[model samples]
Target: MNTPEPLASTVVIKTVNLGRTLMDTEQQPLTILQGINLQINAGDSVAILGSSGAGKSTLLGLLAGLDQASTGEIYLNQQPLTQLNEEQRAQVRQKVGFVFQSFQLLGHLTALDNVMLPLELAGAKDYRKKAQNWLERVGLGHRIKHYPNQLSGGEQQRVAIARAFAGEPVVLFADEPTGNLDQKTGQTIIDLLFKLNRDQGTTLVLVTHDLELAQRCQQRYLLQDQQLILQTPAAVNPVNAEATP
Candidate 1:
């Protein structure tokens, strides 16, 4: 696969022939994905849908600059991520945000403190003020003082979501963000995601198995048998597509 030509418009992220492989215990390389070409326009919301073990998480990690791809190049704001070392990668991280299915919040921190964690680390002086503002926006103002264990699963998820967005990231990536919550709560979080997209024009890349959620995104990609499958706009809801051999 070759690099897809990035649009004339400014894109927040661009991948050139992206691919990834992992090493198994037997010392053999397990090919997780190959020939992935993607372009994310500024403020575009992209949803990645696939079956279990389809490398959704792996793809997200690679895109977030947390993991390196075996081959290919990743550009965040036109900066090549593969060219940068780990410490350099950390610098680029300030422009991106991520939320996981497990709500990887600090177990000991309160909701307010958890949301402030990222901002504080980035050297924001008004971390507390900004964190509280986001908490109130996420409808978790009352739960501010409560620890992770003290809040309900839904509340914890919301806190995680707030934390991810609190820093006001330019690009946001979420992996099964609503996986732990109930249906109603999941829907609420989904709404929050779209709301953030509309209000802030944040570039969003979401990975999920939920058809409805995928449909809501501006663009969608489906992975099957380790290949990139282009999707039509309305095809976000589980449409049949041929898997690459």
Candidate 2:
């Protein structure tokens, strides 16, 4: 008999009965997440859809090793987040990238420098060239020398996206990525995100209130009544469904 090829390793982020509770001044616990279970495979693009106060961002923070859940477990790339100390979790963060809605660029840093910050901190050489290349990829080549204050909101957001991709993180997460821009600019950023997805094979997880944007992903999740729920029978366009098969 012929020898079988080795099975590919599985890369996934998973959570079981994950929960969070906030304590008020009176010491009463207000539960935000209850029994949340989520699983995301490598190279999967997913949108976390929910209204405000639905614990969407909170869940992201926990999964990203930013915060501890009150109950349950989270495994990121087969490592137990709960078992890792703060420093250890920081190490894990090296393999993950994030984009924020607020365009969290430093006012003093130029677009190019902002994108180079992470790489330089990690002691990578030739950071300038790599940063410039990523900025160019986002169509911000001419604006690379511009400071955050000198750039428009959309331009700043593009810089942020460039920075996120510069790190080459295995998993990418975004919170309200397009919430701060005009419809046209936002649409452009969305297109760039998809391009990165197609070219880099990066796993994307985003939290958004926009239905149309969420529908673009392969999977969509909602936080309902303190639970993480995945809705099946995708609302994707019929054209897309037929093309998949």
lDDT of 2 by residue, 1-245 (tens): 44333323555588878999999789999999989888888888898876678888998899888899899888876677877788988998888889999989989889999999999998878899999999999989999989999999889998999999999887888998999888898888888887898889888999887665777889987677898778664543445433321
Give the alpha-carbon lDDT of every model: 0.85, 0.84
Residue range 102-203, candidate 1, lDDT tens digits: 999889899999999889989998999999999899899988999999998888888987888887788999999888888998999999988988898889
In candidate 2, how many clashes are counted?
A: 0
Which portions of model 1 show Cα errors greater than 4 Å?
A: 1-9, 234-245
TM-score of 2: 0.90
Tell me the lDDT of model 2 at 83.
Answer: 73
Tell me the spans in candidate 2 whose CA falls farther than 4 Å from its real position: 1-8, 233-245
